[model samples]
Target: PGGAASNKTYVIYSDNAFPPYEFLDQSTNTYVGIDMDILAAVAKDQGFQYEVKNEGFDASMGAVQAGQADAMIAGMTITDARRETFDFSEPYFEDGQILVVKKDSDAKDLSDLKGKQIAVKTSTQGAAYAESKKDEYDLKLVYYEDSPTMYTALKNGTDDACFEDRMVIQYTIDSENLDLKTVGEVLNPGDYGFAVKKGTNPELIEMFNKGLANIKANGEYDKILEKYGYQS
Candidate 1:
């Protein structure tokens, strides 16, 4: 029932610092990332109105749950826990957790991580994956609210390694020239999706799914992913 000309703007939220996926771009002084671009593309295709809020992940999730935001697309993994509170569209991205260590660290694999500490981002699949393997690896897990801080933990030697999304860690390391390297294979492979408060925004979900299909059919979806260096 809602369209761009209806004068109704849906509030959508994303984490501003999560580069490549969603972050604030200083050159253009605007928010841009895979999630941001996908949302824009979808709105354009579906002819809807929306206001993007580039807040932190926790804040964004809270906003959607509190009914302040109508939806979110922050590279959030589709998990059963999240499904209970939010309705998710078909998965738009494939991602998985990976281990990162200082370039000079001796951590070549999870097997080499005995008695070490690993950094994790709170409330993310990364953190959850770390917890699931911490005991097996004989590791200690340190939590951070954001990625940069957690990455710093590894660089500063405060943490022997970190668990984060493979694409995120790889992109950041190369773009920022971080003194880090990924070891071992990706873990907890899963898909990412756009989400709305459960059972509240059926139309929003419908529009997103429609726009997503259009993009994929028109090759716009692959273009967006390739633009972000997510696809070869």
Candidate 2:
């Protein structure tokens, strides 16, 4: 059996407003996205109970770091820096960051972003990559708690450009009909994983990985990705 059929419940924390990964479905008043569906399917397949917290990304990280959450699956990238604080599961997804500008804008890359504020979600690899090139590109970085806010900043006059996951930005642009265009080459290619506080929740990790494997074999994993419009 993948899971031990524990009656005990686990707590999970995730970013609330990240699209194609996690978001509030206002019509149904339910949380739905790639991350949420993956977690649900994995838990059911593993025969475990869990409760999800829809805190924003910044707060979710804090909750997990403080041991308030057993695991987190917030489209979170796996990185060596985060590994120091969290033990991550096997990589579930691969992605890369890219720069975005408003449609009709002349900015094509970081070079064109000189003196412009670039939007970045707090504590993300995108933010880190933007910072790494800020001086070289002559760019200023502004942080946002969620993707929508960051996109809105670019839509308005608050920000000139932004750095975000390529597919995520593409998803938003297509779904919301945003007049945003991704520019420049992709940056910081990486993998996404579920994470637990370092050295803790080994059983949860074991069951999760087992369930994940089962789902992949049974096509549930690909179905979830399709549900969120991700090409499996």
lDDT of 2 at 128: 92
**What C-alpha lDDT do the candidate models reach, one value each?**
0.87, 0.89
- Candidate 1 Cα misplacement greater than 4 A, ranges: 1-5
lDDT by residue for model 2 (1-232), tens: 4577888899999998888898889899999998999899999998999999999888888898999988899989999999999999988898999889999899877877787899999999889998899889788899999989999999997999888898888888998999899987888889999999999999888888999999999999999988787679
Candidate 1 lDDT tens digits, 51-101:
999877878889999999999999999999889999999999888988898
Q: Worst lDDT window (10 residues) for model 2?
A: 1-10
Error of 1 at 232 (Å): 6.3
Clashing pairs in 2: none
Which 10-residue window of candidate 1 scores lowest in summed lDDT?
A: 1-10
- Clash pairs of candidate 1? none
